[model samples]
Target: MSTVPPLLDGPQADVQVLQALRTTWSDPPGWLGSLRAIDHKTIARRFIVATFVFFLLGGILALAMRLQLARPGLRLVSPEFYNQLFTMHGTTMMFLFAVPVMQAVAMYLVPLMIGARSVAFPRMNAFAFWVFVMGGAFLYAGFALGSGPNTGWFSYVPLASSDYAPGKGVDIWAQMITFTELSALLVAIVLITTIFKMRAPGMTLGRMPLFVWATLVTQFMVLFAMPSVMLGSTALILDRLVGTHFYNPARGGDVLLWQHLFWFFGHPEVYLIFIPPLGFISTIISTFARRPVFGYRAMVLSLVATAFLAFGLWVHHMFATNLPEVGKAFFTAASLAIAVPSAVQIFCWIATLWTGRLVFRTPLYFVLAFFVILVAGGMTGLMLASVSLDLQVHDTYFVVAHLHYVLLGGAVFPLFGAIYYWFPKFTGRMLDETLGRWHFWLFFIGFNVAFFPMHLLGLHGMPRRVWSYSAGLGWDGMNMLATVGALAIAASVMVFLVNLAMALLSGRRAPGDPWGAGTLEWSAACPPPPHNFDTLPVIHGREPRWMQQALPSHVAGLAADAREVLVTSALAARPESRPLFPKPSVWPFLGALATTMLFIGSVYTPWAVVWGALPVTVALIGWFWPGRRETEQALALEQSP
Candidate 1:
């Protein structure tokens, strides 16, 4: 099992095997097939598209808030409506859009990069997507019905408690967290399994792509960081719905406990959003600079160190709260210390760019933007790490500016670059270079104009989360300027949409390896086939394309008559066995429906948890029920290949 099996030959036999694979691996025909499809690419494409739609929706919410704040005392929206607007904007961007989009891209790219046909737990992967859809839909449905959560995205209690904020809105927010976080945990499991046990032969832990390494690191962060929020949200919901005293101060519960749990996940949440983008930056930099990333081992170590240090910095967010001076000092030290690893990564990327020939494609334009914006953001982050600076700027537009600079610059810009870099691989065409440059410049300039003034406004004593302000408070000009810049951002997004549409329609067709890339993903056909590869590739060196200048360079002995993916050891990546992956089913969709009922119903009465379990149990049973064909196939492949 440690080596590849013999290749199939003979024209007639090869034809039959190939045909059987087409039959076995292809989705069932028509719309039904589309619904039941469990292919990683199918799920990832749908997941990615769904997240982008959420991103646009979140942006709309942001623009509305901007319009309301465009001038002092605008009164365009009531304070109540403004609350929901800002609340949903933050919640949607953080929960519905950013984190999931990164995973969605990883879901698509990881399998191809590792030369696996599909992610591990394909059924669970499908389940995760449906669950995510339900969660997002539920949140928006609440908003549409005028029951949107008015509590901030952080939803701090006392303000969020049942006594003060009594409604179904907070309940919806809490339950939505359950759905999204559950989906995230499932995805983390699927990705971790795929990376460790399903990598192509000879791709040991060392030889794995930097993106894959980043993904592996990010998922581990998810495993540790996600549960705290899940627990905290569940407690918040219980306090609201079930008469629990988790956050009720009068009931002997500590309000700060909520903060403890939330920020524990919250600060790491920043890294959760950014680490994958680091991967995107590394990939784009190496590909465009025409060399392997400088200090590859250092880059990998830096990523790991970043995740490790992210947990320690969460306490810094609570510096202004009633905490010990010693604790604040420790977090400040930890916060400043994290810059070491981050700076290491920056210097390594600089070394790679400086010594190598550069290709300034649209993707690189976005990547280069990351340095300017994120570095500036990082400087401000360091400033805020000081308790005095945080106390001065806390709860003000300065904090808002710092967050946007970090998240937008760190994640969003890199993500756009990734789309340009990989769009040809996703679709069979390239994005228009002219429109791309326009999109980048307008977006970059607009982002700064809209946000940078917020820092000065904060310094001038303007608080965030305000519905309206006095007319002559020295804020009108900056407010108008920010509004104009936001409009520019909206326009840039429109240009991007046009570019996407035109590129999909009649842009130049792409080759298998458009960038002359060195990774395994480039070895597949453009917009690769459903099975990914005609032959499951074996790895030789880190850059498989360069090491073995051939498409899909691996021996073939897998079962063509059934769905099979190679499994390997975690460290050396020695071949272990070929396991049969599950096929498409409607059960996951049904299961999500049943689970949604349980979650939403629990919002009304605690009894929902008691009775709702029945249908959920039934759906789980249906989901796991084995087919006769599957049993036979399993028995056939239980031996050596």
Candidate 2:
């Protein structure tokens, strides 16, 4: 009875139906199937989670440093431990936490906002995550083994060499940088491809979200700028490991070359971290304020201009290093040029607040805080851009203050704001508003308290990286105040963690569009579907989902189900052929495992490096393998169906 009942199945019928089902369910050939399987949301979630973990690790390192510096001349840990702490702290926070998190948020949100299913190169996206994980592990293992990089995150040459440091610490730094930058570069490539190639039917580049545009600019910056530093690190690694003379001053190696390469990537890295956050602030302000972004064109142009200008100003970091007067003046002028774009962004943000309805949600609070703190940092940056002023403040607490203000305000503040804004979308639950407010207030106040006095300390002749200083230097009161602020910031972070945990565990369910967000992501399920949308909606303008809601429900639903195709250009409204969705595979995870071994093996023995290379090569080959001829024939039929 079972044999006859199920689709009238004899062996032939059974075979036919099985083949038909396989044809129905199977994905197309090439890497596309693997890519489609991951989807944008999964990739984005991976990016966010991995980055958050790195943030926790980096934050712990920060707390350790703070404890050590809490008092004058009191040793909380050994000097070596302190060195590793600061280096790992800076490296982890900058490379692992800040930049990747920004990209992750963008990755998750951008395609959804634009009404696309997945990013271009979804497999590559998975690969980037694996590389980042491997890189972080390597850094952590190196630290545990007492071989953590000690040449500072920048890893100046002579200090990093075997002659001076005499260990594998610098090697760890170089390798970590290599792995992380490779990850960044991969992400950049994937993002650029997605943004340029995969917008919904009616979404023009001009009509794209400001955050999308900022991300696009950021990807280009990452592609061009990151490689320079990667190259520099490679050079230094060679010099350390194989007796190359690239940075060996005694052997005609120029330390300045290291400075050039580092800052070349470093200065733009500042914007790379800041711009996405700025984009977030822009989007949040406009949404909460209930107004269009002020000077949208200007904001977009400024972002582009900033990327270009960022490269020319790297020499500003070298002002105190006895560079030629001509070189100094060139950098000084280039440094000042950066102020133009920054000022443009600031003015636009202020204008947005002034004109918009300006609701004071938790996210908006952080944006407001960012405005105050960022202005303070920008002013210092302007001052530092001046050759004489930079010379006076270089290597001082002022520099430290300036960087923290910029990073904390520019990156961290907005990062919190983004978390608040998007928490509902990620978890399908609303974060506790009261706790969020508490977190914002505590963080904002504590942040200023911790960093504001550093400017005074810098002016009073206090230098950065000092283990301790005498109480008689008039730095005691400020140091004590700073410590208090640091503790407060730590408490605020604790509150955030608690809030996140509670929200995930038992928070109230959220609406699809909790904030009345204009983006397409808000139109879907709270956490979104695995495919993101059942059908991608055609985006006609900047606020597609918001506009969709204004239409009759049936009309909007019809619009949502249109057969979405990727487009190359807005002007022509050309449609590329629809492609099949990706299917899940173990290759990405296996590849990550191989890469991890390579990094970890390098730390243990030189022979381990050789052995490590084999797995990576094999995994990559398997990852890209075309499969059997029979599988290919079956896939070709499946693709047509």
Candidate 3:
């Protein structure tokens, strides 16, 4: 049966349709226009590139720390500087790189996969990106000024308070948190709305892609999880700036309050950095394995369950803080129980590979390595979930090893896989396979070599965040080995960069469906058009392209003379509105600038809070004001009387 019936009768009609779409959906031309762009693709590309730049910068910090720790008593950096390096490294990896990069991937891929023209809140998407960029810039500016926060990424209070921290560095860190969390929260809201409201016609709840489902759950996590940190940071800022004494235990404030609030956000922050990569794993596995995911309903259920359970595990990070016994037991049980969903996902992927025809591309190599590395990390996590065991190694290298295992293994491994898998789709060219394999192996081996001995160091009682250790304590040899491994990992990253340069410059061209994938995105052109679709596809089932059938219908009647797209009912994707989008504007960027000033100004003086509101209010008013076109139409109607 014909999947899509001809909407236009002939060539002339098709040309007219194309011309109308091009005219209506076109972004403004020139560099200035590009700056004011609201196109999801442009914003997403900026996000992805900015994310990697931060990653590279963070990696350099990691290498610096490794060099300092490579041999005990090697004073590459002083203890104070070491503290700043580690704090910024952790902060950049978690806030500046991981979560934003995952969101960037979704920003680019989600609309294409779901057959939507653009994200639901296009202006907000651009604003989120700008806010993130400015926030990172603000944080790094403190570093450049030699005033980086020295406490930790968690920035536990009393230590991070004005009395002891005694600098603008901690203030900068606190405001950075506020900026980033707000940005993340806004992006999450937009993504959740888009998933629920902007799916193509007939792409019902059950028919949505697994990656989309994973993204939905992750954004919900971000929505629920981000506010706690923002609140905590705001309170911390108030304490630092105005002497509110929220963390001032001597004045009746409880130190444990910061722990509770921070961890409440912190533990889920791990999954915030981890879950979307799980989505990448499922998508890549399904495509390369040449089969439907082994357990679609189960995978969706597991993702939802994982997100819910993630909230309950936050208290586990506070195991050594001397909580009530029952509370500890409850949190430990919750932490351990959370692993069942992860195990289910792991087993399902393994079963899929066992039953299907597995293609071992560079992407799959990383996924395969993820299975080994992440499972190993999960095992260590189970160990740490024990209150007794956690007390023995809570602040030691063991915890460090476990974290990298979960993050690098679970998140970054799949991230690279997704990058290779989707690179062709985005750039219309193939990455060099030989270089890709080299990148994967060197990174994999170097990652293990660098992190594995930390397990032994922890077992031997090596505490974390120490600038130097005594050479006689049986740590020097392993530390040296780790340094070598860190260097290897750095080399691997350099190779990957070279390969990306080669691909962009002169790699073989990619076809639309380079991987013979089974998703709506593959049905579009490689480096798809500005309008996303020449004609909007009507989805019939999951894996529409897999079935090799035309879309069951096309979303017609959406005006091609203006920026109009279908707005659907939340559950069934029944069209509800034909909304017109505003043309790209510079206001979001300008508003973000205003907001950055508010955050930065508040760091030095509390009065900035009162004064900062004026510019912010003005910018927002200008941002949402009706366009000249809309005002003209309203004026014409009024004058007709």
Candidate 4:
């Protein structure tokens, strides 16, 4: 029999390490306990669930939009309601759903794939989830009170000014922006730190999994880019409440400032959403095909180049506003330059598939769809990047079509693939392939049917964001077709939900490594143990687990030992031997509740903001405060057995 030493029984064992291990394995608190479970898997699941809820809400808003615009003179909703629907729809999907879902997948899977016990900052992960939940609730409650934000998702200035809006609507929008961005920023920091510092031993930078690299790049982009939008929104809020003139055009505020600030964050935001999905596709493709990613070096370099180039292309969104010709040319060139790296990635993916033995699975189908749709979006983007072309098609249905293709195709499609791929890992049961295939084809066809005709409608000169249109423009057929497509898409989504429900209830139980994936996540028990691994894994190559499995057991045992190292920094790789990571607490939940009160209070009474702020601040401070007992215990445990 194999004799493994008990970790808790070691003479030199640290008490805090034991405490932390116990905490990590403890049953999550009821209702609130669920929130405190900071395991990467739990956090990731929370991210997916919360974001999916927001996605449903966002989709409902989209349906409302389609109903209102079903025909040229349909009065399904008022102009004001239409504005709120689109605005909230865009905001919810982009900020609340797309980014968070991507991040959630990362949070859950990255640590397992990279062979780490938990993320670098577990508490921060908990905090981000709570804050995001609170933010979404705030926005939803605002709508319930008939004060839904009507500013476009971008909330362009003057239109968003207090005088034009003159209500609590803009405040709700700004606060939602603040709340969600803050959560995203925290996630970015956590992921970046974890990626840089927490990989298993021998996992060099170049040898790091492609998903890790993609996440690293995306997090850096979020870290730097999110601030510009946050600052701009804050400025807008100040203008509304304190009479600041930053974006108030009549008071010497530049209307274009909002554009600059928004796109600064906005352009990179596209890549932030897309890159992680791309990473997911890369990992899934290589694993199922049993091949290393083609042009791995080139793929990594392309990601780096794309990250740098993304920031420079934001002004392409503002090309129609009559900027100086020189500035416009600069942005246009920058925008075109951004496409080169994307093309490189596409080429690399194609090469990988061409050389490898391709496995045709439901996930692979989604990846294939992603490639097709993303390419269409990229072509439209190239068209829009040109100053002349953009001037003609700006704010038209072309832009709408382009945005949907990129966001939905690039982010949502690949994410669906990832969910199907990882569902077994999360639920301990395989998702029904037959049902999943149905979901994929229906969504794929419906999605194309819905958005494809928008390009033609745009070319025929249908401006976007208009609640009603005149029927004689020859636009009614396409609009009606698009609505039908939307319903079809909805139906497909329903199928997916039903499939998920059936899978959870009584589908075939999954086996460990069902897909023969290369990463360490597949090495563990399906639905992995509460503490992940009893012993940390040793990573040798990008496909560590696969390589380990190929070797003899004795060799694999040695490899595991060699791979095991405390998570630490990339610069030094010194082990952070401290044990007993912070245990779960009710503080995050309490903090979120208090903050929600503050947001709702501000909407009704200005002084309510003050009252709301106090409890939230107190709750946060309490949450972060290190109780003397735990601190001393931690210190003692770190010092001695």
lDDT by candidate, in order shown: 0.91, 0.79, 0.89, 0.82
lDDT by residue for model 4 over 1-641, one digit each (tens)?
11122343454344444344445456476876785666667878888899999999999999889877779898989999999999999999998998889899999888887667678777778878888988998899888889999988989888998889989888889888888988899988888877778766666787788888999999999999999999998788888887789986677889899999999999999999989987999998897777888988999999999999998888888887868899989988888888888888889888888988988999999999999999999999989988888889888998899999999999889999999999999999998999999999999999998999999989999999999998899999999999999998999999999999999999899998898888778877888876566556655577876674443321111111111225655844345543455666777677777876786666555688777788989987998898886677555544543
lDDT of 1 by residue, 440-519 (tens): 99999999999999999899999999999998899999988999989999999999999999999989998888887888
Pick the winner on TM-score between candidates 3 and 4: 3
Q: Which runs in model 4 stand beyond 4 Å of their true positions? A: 1-24, 549-565, 571-576, 598-613
Off by over 4 Å in 3: 1-9, 548-551, 630-641
lDDT of 2 at 273: 96
Choose 1 or 2, whichever is better by TM-score: 1
Ranked candidates (lDDT, high to low): 1, 3, 4, 2
- Highest lDDT model number: 1
- Residue-wise C-alpha lDDT for candidate 2, range 1-641, written one tens digit per residue: 01112344467764554344334333344665544345567677778888888888887887777777767787888888888888888898888888888888988888777666677767778888878887888788878988888667887877887788878888888888888888898888878877777777677878888998899999899998899999998888778676789987688889889999999999999989999998898889988988778998999999999989988988888888977999888888888788899889889988988887867799999888888898899889989988888888889989989999999899999989999999899989999999999999899888888888889989999888777677677888888788788888989999999999999999999998888777767888888765466545666667775574443321111111112234455343345645443345567768877887786566546576789989989988877776575355445534542
Looking at model 3, which ten-residue stretch has the lowest summed lDDT? 1-10
Per-residue alpha-carbon lDDT of model 3 for 215-298, expressed as tens digits? Answer: 999999998888898988888988887878888878888889998889888999889888999899999999999998998999
The best candidate in terms of TM-score = 1
Cα miss at 568, model 2 (Å)?
4.3
Q: Could you tell which candidate, 1 or 3, scores higher by lDDT? A: 1
Per-candidate TM equals 0.97, 0.90, 0.96, 0.92
- Pairing residues by index, what is the TM-score of model 1? 0.97
Worst 10 residues of 4 by lDDT: 554-563
